[model samples]
Target: MATFTPTKPRTIGHVDHGKTTLTAATTKVLAAEGNAKAIAFDEIDKAPEEKERGITISRSHVELPIVSGSGLYALQGTNEELGEKAILKLMDADPVRQLYRPFVMPIEDIFYIQGRGTVATGHVEQGTIKVGEEVEILGLTQGEPLKTTVTGVEMFKKLVDRGEAGCKVGLLLPGLKHGDVQRGMVIAKHGTLKTYKKFEAQIVYVLSKFYLRTADITEKVQLPDDVKMVMPGDNVTATFELTLPYPLDHGQIFSLREGDRTVAAGVVSKVLS
Candidate 1:
């Protein structure tokens, strides 16, 4: 077996970017090139539509074999518990009664995409917050809509006290008012947040109608601000100038736009001219 150390956490990117295709291709290529059956991986079948659409909807686990000894023995993937057999057993046992339970597992300090919006119920992996601690709801503009604090926390026999990381959390706010705030936004705790409206970022190009350069027309820019110009050159890197009043923070991930669609997604590097 091989032993490896990770410098950065590994999480699956969502579908539509050919995540599934990428997985299959990479898996087959590795298996063909390698001598052994290569370690196994767990693919999360979270959505029926994902199967139909031929895209990976849930977070799946894949084992990457390290080249160490002649006969490898160790195996590593994302999650070992949520396998297909375990999931099938759970689903077949008593879904109706078990629907009101918190996750059989726990997720903390991780990012996930919302496949659906459903009622929230249960004791979360992490305890729920009180009415004092501030929380920031993101995703309204490409993050999640997080409602921190216990101002409206309630007890439900079926619902959990807190929400897990991977599942969707529905908030029942009576007098809340957010106009035209649709899906695909992220919500989180509000604090001394970071900003970098006009900065450089590293990105991987997925879909491109035509090769882009500085000042190329793009609709991937979605900040609540105006863009002065765009520059592209370095491999998976670009320079962006925003005309918004909000702040852009370091390490923020955003889907870059050319005109009306996302061209690439990237993390903020540095504010450049």
Candidate 2:
């Protein structure tokens, strides 16, 4: 079978923002074209509260066809009634993209165990990790990636020889210190990941205070559209500079957050070299 790249989409906004309606429309259109995955389009609003209130009270998943890609794409219709923090939890729990690489784990924290040397903790983003496997740490500093080896793996205080993506665990690395690597860094199969400081993305409309931001400055920049300020609903393609280098891949879904609210969400389209 020919391979197809998958793009997962989510409808985001405040309560009663029509997230379900948009998702249903996409599902209906896909079903008309003989796509079986979209047949259960109405299931998204299956919650009793949604039917009674005519609002989306829970999340839904469907495989809808993308008019441009001509392929079925996984779409998530999020619960419109969720608060900012709850919404973030939903996003992280059911993240749009799935890991398919050899091994990809974004570092969340790093520390030195009493005797275990340098320990980095994070959930495996993709692929499988095994003890004694050599890996590379990306986005720590510019230039080439920092090379290291996995000396130990522990999940919930239990020793494990292997771990797959999404499994939360701490990995032990020798000859490294907590100061050497920190959060926002990525651990992946050697030579398989790239880091970036700038990228281009397709931002979907939602509750946002600022879409364009300046590096290390509180002043916000004018969007390419030149709008005085972006509001709760608007679509714009804008280039953004990451606060720190990241290994975010193209077609991956992410969100712009502040405090507890996610101001906006988007898909990484082009990696700006």
> All predictions: root-mean-square deviation over Cα?
15.6, 13.7
lDDT of 1 by residue, 149-221 (tens): 4233222222334433333333322222434222322233355333223566677653332112111222233
RMSD of 1: 15.6
Off by over 4 Å in 2: 1-100, 205-222, 225-228
- Give TM-scores for every candidate, taking all chains together and pairing residue i with residue i: 0.34, 0.56
**Model 2 quality (TM-score):** 0.56
Model 2, poorest ten-residue lDDT window? 212-221
Off by over 4 Å in 1: 1-133, 137-158, 178-186, 192-196, 204-236, 243-249, 257-262, 271-273
- Tens digits of lDDT, candidate 2, 214-252: 112121222576655566778877776664566767886
lDDT of 1: 0.37
- Among these predictions, the greatest lDDT belongs to 2
Name the lDDT value of residue 180 in candidate 1.
22
